[model samples]
Target: MYQNLDLFQTSGAMARHAGSRQAVVAQNIANADTPGFRALQVPSFSEAVKNSGVGAMKMTRSNHLHGDTKAAVVARVIESAAEPAPNGNSVSIEDEMLHSVEVTREHSRALAIYRHGLTVIRATLGR
Candidate 1:
């Protein structure tokens, strides 16, 4: 299946992780004024890939060898250890906004990679 393809797997994973992270960032911003609410975070892209159980891979290009020919990603939720406000809320709107921008960029990068991969396939097939 296409899911096993490193290109697709990594791209899909990045998209999914970015989407989930955006949701969590929104949740944090929504709770910014709530009492006892701690800011939440999703694992970084690299960490997500590591946690997703995508094992190491090796390849042979005649006399050349390759590693990690495949990749995938997933995320886990964790609370930030930032200093809490007097009201027990740790959410910072500024930080959340920055995180939001980062998530958007990652999502776009993922989509671009997937799109280019498909384009390459189409060109190769002369379709």
Candidate 2:
């Protein structure tokens, strides 16, 4: 009966997204000194969800809905829009540090959501 619970799925997705973003930030930092290496970034969680059509109608069969099915919410890495330095490298250690902090917060928020959801479920069951 709980197989369709979206709360857990959402929290998990959020956590996964944060992890992906963190990886990209790490990559950017690692290449900070590489000439011509542009910084990379992933879109925000909200944008990813919106573009993926997470809550949209699904097509069980090709002809079922006559529309596109929901796409997987993937955290795609894109080239950052930051201006490149004289060496042609775009990564800024300060910016990457800030991104790391943001990713940490996002992961923590996801965990809190999942934990609170479990607590609410337990309370509902009088556990």
Candidate 3:
């Protein structure tokens, strides 16, 4: 029933985006010492959610390659801007930690919004 509601979809997308970012940050931190390892990052939650509505392309002709529009909507991994150390490793522990904190906050905020919206709906229905 909630699928019809845009609020639920937005909150869910935000949560997914945050989780993806957190995972990328964690991986970067884990590989900080690996030589030639480059840090990676994903787009912000708002940006991912903003472009989530694009529909999948229709296969009008056999020459057209199939594509999943939904997959494209998710965050894209990009190289981080952190300066590389002498070993050519670009992962910075301090920066990754800060990014992790931001991801946590975004996840929590999205969850809170979802819960509060449900509460308001329940109150309206006197449930």
Q: Largest lDDT belongs to which candidate?
A: 2
List the candidates' TM-scores in order.
Answer: 0.82, 0.87, 0.81
Give the clash count for model 2. Answer: 0
lDDT of 1 by residue, 23-107 (tens): 9999999999999999999977877767765766654355556665444455789998779999999999999999999999999
Q: Which stretches of candidate 2 lie over 4 Å from their true place?
A: 1-3, 59-71
Model 3 C-alpha lDDT versus the unseen true structure: 0.83
RMSD in angstroms, all models?
A: 4.7, 2.3, 5.1
Q: Rate the local accuracy (lDDT) of all candidates.
A: 0.85, 0.89, 0.83
The runs of at least 3 residues in candidate 3 whose Cα sits more than 4 Å from the true structure, single-residue gaps closed, are 50-72
User: Comparing candidate 2 with candidate 3, which one achieves the higher lDDT?
Assistant: 2
lDDT (Cα, tens digit) per residue for candidate 2, span 32-85: 999999999998788899988887877868878555565568898899999999
**lDDT ranking of the models:** 2, 1, 3
Q: How would you encode candidate 3's per-residue C-alpha lDDT over 1-127 as one tens digit per residue?
A: 8755768877887888899999999899899899999999997876664666444464556677884424335788999888899999999898899999999999999999899989999999999
Best candidate (score: TM-score): 2
Worst 10 residues of 1 by lDDT: 63-72
Clashing pairs in 2: none
